[model samples]
Target: MLNSINTNPGALLALQNLNATNTELSTTQGRINTGKKIANAKDNGAIWSMAKMQSASSQSLNAVKDSLQRGQSTIDVALAAGDTVTDLLMKMKEKALAASDTSLNTASLKALKSDFESLRDQIQKAADNATFNGISLANGKTAKLVFLANADGGSFTVNAQTLGLAGLGLSLTATFSTASDAKTMIAKITDALQTATNKLSSLGTSSVGLDTHLTFVGKLQDSLDAGVGNLVDADLAKESAKLQSLQTKQQLGVQALSIANQSPQTILSLFKG
Candidate 1:
């Protein structure tokens, strides 16, 4: 109630309240602008730190996904080539069976031999061309390929299979020159077919494994993103409502301060009277 010119308690109290309202208004405005309640360490240190750590982990999974995808592609290439070789071996078996017939003419036998050789060469070509990223799983040269599986430094190892002619125990000079030779050729072709089939199965299994893990990694990354959002994301609806209230409070605070500033003038009126 004391209205001294030098010391006005009412004005001081009004200023204090106005300053408080201004601080609240500033905080609400910041939340609205950034769309985050914990935009930085200053907002909420513990929550912000947790969100940042999870975000980094989610980003790291991107590299893991890339590695898994690359591994899958390589295996797919090998599988395709192996399948081609298997089909070629089946055709060679047909040619060899025909060549083994004792009644066949020389011209027919020569034609069968030519066809068989062409198929064998094609199988070798398939193995040679089954390369992806400089890695040929069917060429009997590449070692086991490893891909990152998760954020914990774990990995998936894809074992490579030997699918080339020599690797499959098939000699390049294997021929059907006579009935006996044709029977030997038949055995070699059958063995090669079996080997190629097994290799394809192995590669197919690895592809499936990579695919399943990739799906899991994607889901885990999504969960991490959601967790980070829960920690730091702002509720725009709530912030909007709070912003309106704070703006109104700030206006009222300014008016109250104005009225308190006029209390000193009342002392001048008292002296005049």
Candidate 2:
């Protein structure tokens, strides 16, 4: 309660409190604007670093997801082509059965032979065109696809199937010249159909496996994003409350400083004579 002309302790104390309140106000306002508690390394070095690392991990997983998608697409194209080839083989089997009846006339036999050859050529064409992203599973063009972006040992492997007619033991020069030839042709076509079916099944399995891996990676990326948010994101509700309280404290600080500044003037009244 002592007042001196040379020193003003009240003013000094009020100024100190005002500066502290201002600092808090500035920090609260920053959070409100940026919506982040740790906007930079200066805010919280340890937490910022951790969030940064997780963000990098999320990016890597995103790349893995992309690769998985591409691999799935490639497998899909191959499966479709294989299914068409299976259908073609079945038709060829019917033609072989018809041709086996040596009682048929020469004209009818030639027609059957032409129809069968056309189907065989179509199977080859289907295999050749079954490509996605410049990748073909049949024709032994590609064997496997791997997707793992991180340096750590984690990846999804998708296997390809060889459903090409040539791969299935279907020879281009194979012809049904006699009833005996027709019997042999039927067996070979059956075997090729079964082989293509097995390859299709394997491709389907690989597709499902890749899908499962992609789903898991999606969830993992989401978790990483949430973790980063927990480390750096601000609670706007909490910041709003602090902002109002600091504003009130600032007003009080100003009033206190005004009162202290007037104390020096009170010394003038004491000198009245």
Candidate 3:
């Protein structure tokens, strides 16, 4: 090889190799620092795009879970109101029976009537308080609670069962003026009790269904998150090993470049007078 400073092919080749090694080292260091193989679209276009899509899906599923929670709370409030109203109806029924008996005196009948009136009023109060997030499912304020299940326009709708006194056909506002009146109200109260019980059962089932759907959504989100991780998360162990190797190669590249640069000085040795 002729020692000529004007034409240094070895130096050019060594510089090119060093530049390549530096690029590899930079990439490996980025992976180590960020712990992501695809931090941007430039990393791996296809994998980064797929991971972003999965991340969006996971976020949507989380939103669905939140909706399910609100739906469940609304239904639960209605169910609790139905339970209270049902209990009140049972007490009212017993009061009606006691007042209807011929053996009961006028004062006894009046006392039973007063208790029955109070219990009946509580049913309305329970229905009023059953509202959740401004939704009165038990009192006929709304027809249903709709929860989004996914980003694909799917949903879960729970039909509201109005368990109010008017809803149960128990709107006899007049107090028991006589035994006959008390007897007449018993049948209606019995029906209302059964109706309220049925509504509670339905609401409970819907709440359980919502809970189940939330569980399913959580699992779906976990799967999507794992998919995103698989696509973009770096294997630190592998990256660390690569980092060590790149550091070694970077040093070797520097040494080789240094050796190539020194070749031009060798031409001076021929003229060393």
Candidate 4:
């Protein structure tokens, strides 16, 4: 109520009100521009810290997913090689059976023997070539493929199944020249076929497991992202409305301050009378 030329109480009061409104307007504008209610530690320290931790976890899962995918691809290569070996064994068994027939001529037996030898060699080649990323699971090159499963330092291992000729009990030196030799080979081929088939099935199962875990990791990362968003993301609609209201208040505050600053002129008028 004091109207003094030296100090205007009304102007000081209006300036304080205007500064408060400006602060609120600045905050609202920040939320709208950044689209985050807690953009930094100053905005909301506790919530921002929590969101950062969750975001780190989500980012770490990206590495885990990559590891799992690499493991899956390695297993898939092994499975493909095992399947080829199995097929070759089956074909070799057919050739040996044909050679086992006593009625077959010497030339016919020799032809069948040649075909069997070629098919038998392919099994070794297939196993040796089952490689991915410089690692092989079928030729005794690698014992297992281990991959990260989670952000908590957990892992999964896919044990290797060696499918080499020696590993499968198949002899590369075995001959199929006579009926008795051919019968002997048939037995060995049967056992090798069974072993290769089982190995392939195991690898297939491992591939499926890797794929499932990878999908789960992806979903978990998405959930973490959503959690972070819930903690810090701004509601644009609400912020927009608040921005408009604060802008109006700021305009009104300026006008009020201007009127208060003119109060010294009123004191002069009183003296003029």
Candidate 5:
């Protein structure tokens, strides 16, 4: 099927070479502009699937980090309130000792009792108000926090147990009327202070444990983020180098196609002979 007019083999070959060069140039340009080997899901289904999984995992890790931060803050508030309550209880104990001394007159003893009552009220107030994000960490309220790890299929829960004055057996309702009664109240207050101290000590330990866990969770989140970044993030330096190389190859490809088309042009000179 060779029925064509003015079909100089040189022109036909030049047109074909030009078309191929243009296609290669367009592809290289697209890659340079997009800065990705597979910019769309259709380009590389497997890579895209893995990238989506990494993205989902990164989001989950961020959520866990937020939860751990809130937990740490709650524990911090509870520990501070516990310290305040402990201090007030110690002051009340001192007042009780003063009231028990008969050397102090009735008026002085009555004032001392009033001061002790005020301190007890303060202790209860602190316990009641120790809260974080509307979640009370003190006053014997229980809460459980959980952390999930996807890779290891591991999880752990942290419980906020009773760390209140009542839990420490510190009864703030005891009455001190007579000097002897005041002495008995002082013993009770002293014992309660010791109990509260021990509980605060325990709370301190628990708070430290929570802090440690939070730190561990934070590190894990960071590592997960890094992993996700590695999966999908672009290497700008490498991409830039590739862009330069591709541009040079595209230029050379065009020149080579021009030379290939001219190979058939040598036949035109034979016709002149």
Candidate 6:
């Protein structure tokens, strides 16, 4: 059915083509402006799901990193206290040796006993005060730290390891009842020093091992963060190029739309002729 004056198929077809071009141009412009191929939930459901997963993983990794850092700090505090205790023990041993001398008078031996008592008090104080984040590491507390993989949901346990102070066999109590008893007491203090020294050496080894574990976990966290960034981070160069192209296409689409609207005027001129 042929119908209508001032109606031209050429003009109609051109207008339709122009409209389609305009829609395409607008879509590209939106992508350019947002710098995202899929800016909304409806754009790419699969990619959105993957991005969410990456975000969740990144959060978990960060939490694990914090846990490991606190664990390291706690271990450092314990190690430092251990070192202080060993030094005090060494000093006490020296005082014990001095007391062993027979030339020393009763007064001198009594003073040496007092010095030994003071050193023992200092060791106990160091142990009692060695804490991190309100958790004691050297006070014979049951604290342990643990690290886990992402597959395990990044699970971690704190306050699990406790140093056994009593097991180290260090006696700090004054035992000399007389000047003659000073020799035996000094020998006992020496034995305790040796035992404490061995315990401190073991603790040093454990501290080194914990530090190594922390280093490994830190590296793993870095790698996980990089992976998360790769999943969602924008490519600025590509976005910039796309913006330029979309702008040009938009301009061309506007011109094409203008030309299509003018095509109907040709039919009006034919009717006047």
Angstrom error at residue 108, model 5: 0.8
Candidate 3 stretches with Cα past 4 Å from truth are 172-175
- Can you list the residue pairs that collide in candidate 4? none
Q: Candidate 6 at 128: error in angstroms?
A: 1.1
Candidate 1 colliding pairs: none
Using TM-score as the measure, name the better of candidate 1 and candidate 5.
1
RMSD of 2: 1.5
Worst lDDT run of 10 residues, candidate 6, spans 158-167
Model 1 deviation from the true structure expressed as Cα RMSD, one decimal place = 1.3
Q: Lowest summed lDDT over 10 consecutive residues: which window, candidate 3?
A: 168-177
Count of steric clashes across candidates, in order: 0, 0, 0, 0, 0, 6
Question: Which scores higher on TM-score, 2 or 4?
Answer: 4
TM-score per candidate = 0.96, 0.95, 0.94, 0.96, 0.79, 0.80
Pairs in clash, predicted candidate 3: none
Model 6 gets an lDDT of 0.66
- C-alpha RMSD values across all candidates: 1.3, 1.5, 1.6, 1.3, 4.1, 3.6
Writing each residue's lDDT as its tens digit, candidate 1 over 190-262 gives 8888878887888898899999999999999999999999999999999999999999999999999999999
Candidates' C-alpha lDDT: 0.90, 0.87, 0.87, 0.90, 0.69, 0.66
- Score candidate 4 by TM-score against the native: 0.96
Alpha-carbon shift of residue 104 in model 3 (angstroms):
1.3
lDDT of 3 by residue, 114-142 (tens): 99999988888899789878887888878
Q: After TM-score superposition, what is the CA distance of residue 78 in candidate 2 from its true location, in Å?
A: 0.8
Give lDDT tens digits, candidate 4, residues 184-268: 8899888988888888888888888999899999999999999999999999999999999999999999999999999889766
lDDT of 5 by residue, 78-97 (tens): 77887887798779889888
Which tens-of-lDDT digit does each residue in 1-273 have in candidate 6?
333456755557657766776676666666667666666667678876787776576667666666667766777887788777778767876887777788888898889888878887887788778788887667776555564534345544544323333534554465453556666766766676676666566556656665665677667767766775565455768767765776676577667667766765655676684
For residue 99, give model 2's deviation from the true position in Å: 1.6
